[model samples]
Target: MDVTTRIGVVMNGVTGRMGYRQHLLRSVLAIREQGGVPLSDGRRVLLEPVLVGRGATKLRELARRHDVEHWSTDLDTVLGDPRWQVYFDAQLTSVRHKAVVAAIEAGKHLYTEKPVAETARQVVELARLADAAGLRHGVVHDKLFLPGLLKLKRLVDAGFFGRVLSVRGEFGYWVFEGDGQSAQRPSWNYRKQDGGGVVVDMFCHWNYVLENLFGRVRAVTAKAVTHIPRRWDERGEPYEATADDAAYGIFELDGGIIAQVNSSWAVRVHRDELVEFQVDGTEGSAVAGLWGCRVQHRSMTPKPVWNPDVPTTERFRDQWAEVPDNAVFDNGFKAQWEQFIRSVAGDGEHPYDFYAGARGIRLAEAGLRSSAEGRRVELEEIAP
Candidate 1:
């Protein structure tokens, strides 16, 4: 690698679990240690993250533990610094738009977690602002970078899917209430006032996943509910779950493919993976998760004669083939971070920009609207 060009990034909300583990520990720090992301031109962009968060102890502990030299509690001061060219946010969804807007006004390149804003308007507005300033901006769409999804994309690209039929995605795991065991997630995730809802959170993810893999989500018919009314908080106190813990949705995609996804924090996992998508096409079908993918071709499909009279024994589970990892796979979030930094360095084109993030927010909004109105809402066509 040529002399590495360090890109200083102000990382906020990294004290949180997802932010800390995925963005900081797995992505940024890993990139730094590995001598940065390689560009097509041979040069590399080394990420220098300045850990910023609300809690001083956590920040300090994280900094010391991770050997991060620069850390700050003041976001404004960090953003004002000329040394840092990128401002990254993993903060609460409620405050994300305001922070991103401030970062944009500061004339810095931007990167942040999903659902860039609470509303579609704000998401689009951020994309507009970033475009107007001619600054590089990206939001997390890590699912696309997952190894399983990558393999699935390869199948689609290879014409293995032929004409795609329908997609079914199941994403959920039980989150223990604070009563008997500590809740795995923060209490804010269960409170709507804190911008907590399954539709807003997971639909943003499903948006790009479906769009990129299957097709664009044209319309959505959804039902959302707060499955658990009350849950114990970190303080061992019971609080009303104002947010929807569960959401069941069916999306009408382009090319007449139907997509259905169920997201819930209250459900138990019974599938092979915690989150899985089964894509059934004309010629073949594939089930993909974060790490693994299984495929079954129409030619290899089991044909069992339907007989209600007697129980037939056929090994249906053994019919499909598992997609092997011929190559080492990087962390999903880390992979996206590398691509984003490469794009920032003018090495590659990353189309998953702020506009894509807005589309994600649009899908989320559409799901909420459909659930509320009990009608399928059409997605306003946006540029891919």
Candidate 2:
């Protein structure tokens, strides 16, 4: 695979966890090591990712460790370079709007993490700017590329569900208190001032999952709670947690489908997977997790009569059949990156653009409003 042409990408915030592990190391650099991504006509698209961040020490160590040749602390210098065609942002959600806007203005294609901006208005503005600038852009909708969800989507497309009645999503894991156990997440995640909250974080993911797998979300009724009031910061200083630790939401989607999601940083894991969606339909039911999906057809579904007098012997978990993992699955983020690169190369089209990102933030905003007002909030699309 001797490829002559290459696509230079400016990747900001690559020193962070998601940026470093998922975007930089696994996706971009991995593609680089593989020579290039193959196209249908026996062509290859080479990716050259330049790491950009604030700290030189972190950048130096990261670049050295990951075999990255280019590293820069000044973002403006990187953006000004004509070689870099794409600007990928994985920075803090608060800072992404300005950086992405700058990239769009620079005539660079854009790709970034979820919640493109802290507000839905900002997302719409960015989308409009990208469109006006005639630059192609995409946002991370990594969940859609996951193997389990793909299987579930296949069931829906094959009409195995008949008619979806409702969907139940359980997504959460215990984040250790900074008292004696070190917190797994960044310290800023518990602070509202830093743009942290369960509803804002999780609902963005749920929005696409619901819309893609079931239907478009129309309204939401939500309740949020800050279960932990005080927590230790990165420096071991105690601080008041201003953001919501947990959020329970009920969504009304098109076709009268009901979707319920419970997102928390306080709940312990007791299920088969960290995140699971149990979808009930008229003809059958299926439960899809992060990597696996199980289905129980109506014919195979057991019927249990209400009987308190006699001890039950029927095993519930044994009835469902596991969806076969017949295909090799790649990392979800990498899967999306390949498609985005193909789209950027003018070899394909991508739909998960800024408009999709705006839709995600729109749902998050509606969930927050519903929780605050104690009423159902209807989604209103913004025209920018």
Candidate 3:
């Protein structure tokens, strides 16, 4: 007795790069192709997305391209409709709060991209609203679902790395200056007024990674800087890069774990992956990238003597063993989407909700504050 239930969703901000590629194309469409999300009781939840955005032309194009039955430029009308049960947002950080608030008022279960709002206060307010309305709400925690990180978590869970010590993370690559070549990232990413900055964007991610894998973040000391003074926009117009393009942060996690992460858009890549983390512990150590992970256990630890006079002979990089994927890995965004859909259908509670999103925002705020004041900022528990 398998039953397929169609869940209508109002999807806003599909015109943006992340919204279009990851959410619309990869996650939602891929789920539909897979015959929806399966429940334990032989039931399936099929998503029906109604594309909503500011640009009618873009929405119409996307709807037609995806063969979506419904598309709308009028968010109010779409929100007022009782047919749509869920609302998903991948909008800009600056404008996300209002739309999320409206969706909650309309009684739609919420699923959204991180930094749910510009500030911690706003995210807490949204969490309260969703709770009051008795709706399922979730913020994306995609990085945890990454294959490399998943393997890292598996090792941690298996006690492979007994008594974790510290973590070092490196993320980012050079963005072409608009003057010589077109910038890879959006121009707004370098503008502070539009909620742009490496600290605001990356600290949110670092906070969750540290909190989930190691321990909750206790304090943060960060240095944020604008390395490149000016860059060209999409239209080839020159503008001052007012926002910080780079951030070097030291986070103190619970249980005496120290995590250092460097996020930048100005640095050149010298590693296999754009983002990588090296976790050191008492028993073992591991280096994990976006898709690959290598580990060196205590039993196989290599000891080399430092000799500056002669050429180094030890192949340090080749010493670690690669971590294999024990199971098939789904697209991170798609997996999270399925989980959120299940929660909306009363399968179970979504773990990364608005409250979690607020904590990320708080971390970003703390990092920025620390940079501005030249001091360490301690994290305060946010009331759920």
Residue 151 in candidate 1, Cα distance off native in Å: 1.4
Clashes of each: 0, 0, 0
List the candidates' TM-scores in order.
0.97, 0.97, 0.98
Specify the poorest-scoring 10-residue window by lDDT in model 1.
375-384
Best candidate, TM-score-wise?
A: 3
Q: Kindly provide the TM-score of model 1 when superposed on the true structure, using C-alpha atoms.
A: 0.97
Candidate 3 clashes between residue pairs 3 or more apart in a chain or in different chains: none
Deviation in Å, model 2, residue 380 alpha carbon: 1.0
Residue pairs clashing in model 1 are none
The TM-score measured for candidate 2 stands at 0.97
Residue-by-residue lDDT tens digits, candidate 3, 276-342:
9999999999999999999999999988988899999889999999999989999999999999998
Using lDDT, give the best candidate's number: 3
The 10 consecutive residues of candidate 2 with the worst lDDT sum are 1-10
- Would you list the C-alpha lDDT of every candidate in the order shown? 0.89, 0.90, 0.93
Question: Cα-based RMSD of the predictions, in order?
Answer: 1.4, 1.5, 0.9
lDDT of 1 by residue, 59-103 (tens): 999999999999988888888998899989999988888889889
